[model samples]
Target: MAVDAARDGVRSRAPARERLRAGGRISRAARYLFFGAVLGYFCIPMAAVLIYSFATRWTANVLPDGYTLDWWQATVSNPRIQSAFSTSMALATLTAFIDIAVVVPAAYWSRVRNARIRHVIEVAAAVPFALPYVVIAFGLMQFSGVVAPQFQGTFVLLVAGHAAIAFPFVYWAVDGAMAAAGIERLSETAEACGASPMQIVRLVVIPNISSGLVTGGLLSFAASFGEFAMAQIIGRGLDTVPLWSAEMIRSYSDTAGSYNRLAVVTLLTFAVLFVLSAVVVYWNRGQTVRLLPGAGASDEGGRR
Candidate 1:
């Protein structure tokens, strides 16, 4: 009777275990399916654009009738496109640097010393998102007219606008980094060691928050590069990439090879962003090793 009862128990438990295994498999399969679908959704359009850029003619076909490098050549050689690309690059780079210089210290100070001022900074950062781009541009234009008339319709105004709008990105990134790094504790420790405020920030704070700085800088750069509405208003005829791309589409929509050129530009932009992302990832890995206690030592031991 005892043996029979034990067999019955074992039989019941086996089915339950089998069902749990099956459910786990189904869950994993579903997750993989969802991930693949999302990947495809984003990648397909870009793949099509890349193909079209090289296509000599692709009308109502599954693939191009032929392929050529004419569009790439034209886009590279065009002086107007070159000028626009350079302008966008310069503006984005400047905005990223300015945001880093301004936001890092402010975020560090807020995190370490006066938490009360953080709310005010948060409100200021959120202002760009709360208001429309058009309104912001108009307001800036009016303000610049009164305060610095010479800055009107110049790259200075564009950079200022870009920096203002991109502020939130840098601020949020640095704030999160500060929190994660336990900036208050770190600052206290450094001070206890007789380090000055500047030394603490330069030596302890910045090194720990390098990942956030890169991330924020990248976001700021991307935002400035892609911004259109404010650039259109404040730029006053400045030929950034967005403005030039708009003009290309509006004026040459029907012209032969115009779309191919646009596709080339799109791919180039994607490449630049991808390279930046790669850099960030590589930098973050090093930062991860440095930030975690004993991680670097463990890695070195494993290597040995």
Candidate 2:
């Protein structure tokens, strides 16, 4: 009688467990379906653009009649495009450098020295997001007009504007990195060891937060590279990539194969951003080793 009753209990629980397993499988399948749908939604358009860039003649057909490298070659070899690309690169590099120089020290000081000032710093950083790019661009234009009219439509103004807008990226990155590194505690320790503020920042803070610096700098570079409104208003004389692409779209609307060249430019921009992102990821992969306790000592011992 006892054995029979035990078998009955086991049979009852087995069906419940089976039902749960089936339900879990259904739920997982649903999640995968949703993910795939979302991925397809975003990826399909980009794939189309990529295909069109290589297509020699794509009409109303399902596929291109043929494929050729003419678009890529023509777009890359165009002197105007080359000039625009170089200008964008130079502006992006300058913006990234300026942001890194300003934000790293400001963030470090706010985190270690004066927590009270952080609110003010955060508000300043948030200004770019709160205001539209057009507003900022016009405001800078007006301000520059008043203080220095000679600076209007100059690369100097463009760099200043880019730096202003890209400031938040570097600030937030460095601030997060400093928090993660526990800069306050590190600073205190260094101070106890009779290290000066500059020494502490140079020796301890910067090294620990190098990942953040690179991430921030790359983000700033990407932002500056794609910026249009400020560049349009304040950099009228300059020919950046975005401006050139816009001109191709607007002025050459009737020109055959114009879109293919534009598509090539778009892909090139994506490639540059991808490379920068990969750099940041590669830089971050080393942070774990650097942050581990006694990592420096371990390295020295291993070397010896």
Candidate 3:
């Protein structure tokens, strides 16, 4: 009877261990499957674009019969494309700078003032993101004639439109960083040391939140660079890369050259944004390492 009882206990323990092992294996399998699906979803479209960019002909065939750089060359040589590309780069940089300048101060002020004010400002910052693009565009157009007639159809308005859309991204990025860094405590410390508001901002606040500032600025720049709807309506017939690409697609010819050219433009935009994103990622890693405990000691040891 004792032997039978012992046997039963052993059997129960064996099944429990096996069940845990099976559950772990299933969990890992599910995680891999989920990630694999996500990876494929993004990579598949990018792979298609890359392949099509070099193809001389794709229609009615599994792959291009020939490959050529003629489309890329043509795109590079086109004066209109050159102008639009430069315009986008310049506008994106300017818009990003403006966003940084505006968002950082506003976020800091709201935090320093009161909770109600901060909430109100946060809602206001999100207005552009929440409102439909059509509504914003129409409102801008409606007021363009009356508010600032001379400003309409100029680069100023284009920058303004881009800035409006990009502000929320900048605001959230910097605001979150401030909160995470415990800006209020840091400010109190600075005040205890007899630092002025300006001194605290320049010496303490900016340095601590530098990572967030870079991230926010770059994100805002990318947003402005790729904005289509606002540029189309608020730009008042501006010749942006997106608008030009749309026109090319609309007036497609029987030949595959047009499609190839469009693909090249698309890839160019992707490459630029990809580089910026990579920079941000690398910078963030460095920031994280620097902020980690005993990071300086590790660095000194490595140097030795």
Q: Which candidate has the highest TM-score of all?
A: 2
TM-score of 2: 0.82
Q: Give the alpha carbon lDDT tens digit for every residue of 150-243 in model 1.
A: 9988998999899999888777667667777998999999999999999998999999888788877887888888898899988987999988
Candidate 1 vs candidate 2, lDDT winner: 2
Deviation of model 2 at 5, angstroms: 41
Off by over 4 Å in 1: 1-37, 281-304
Q: Tens-digit lDDT track for model 2 on 61-119?
A: 89998899989999999999999999999999999999999888878877777776778
For model 1, give the 10-residue run with minimal summed lDDT.
Answer: 4-13
Which pairs of residues have clashing backbones in candidate 3?
none
- For model 2, the local distance difference test gives 0.82
lDDT of 3 at 122: 57
Which prediction has more favorable TM-score, 2 or 3?
A: 2
lDDT of 3 by residue, 77-159 (tens): 99999998898888899999998888787788877766676677656655675687667877887798798988887888889
Error of 3 at 229 (Å): 0.4
Instruction: State the local distance difference test value for candidate 1.
Output: 0.80
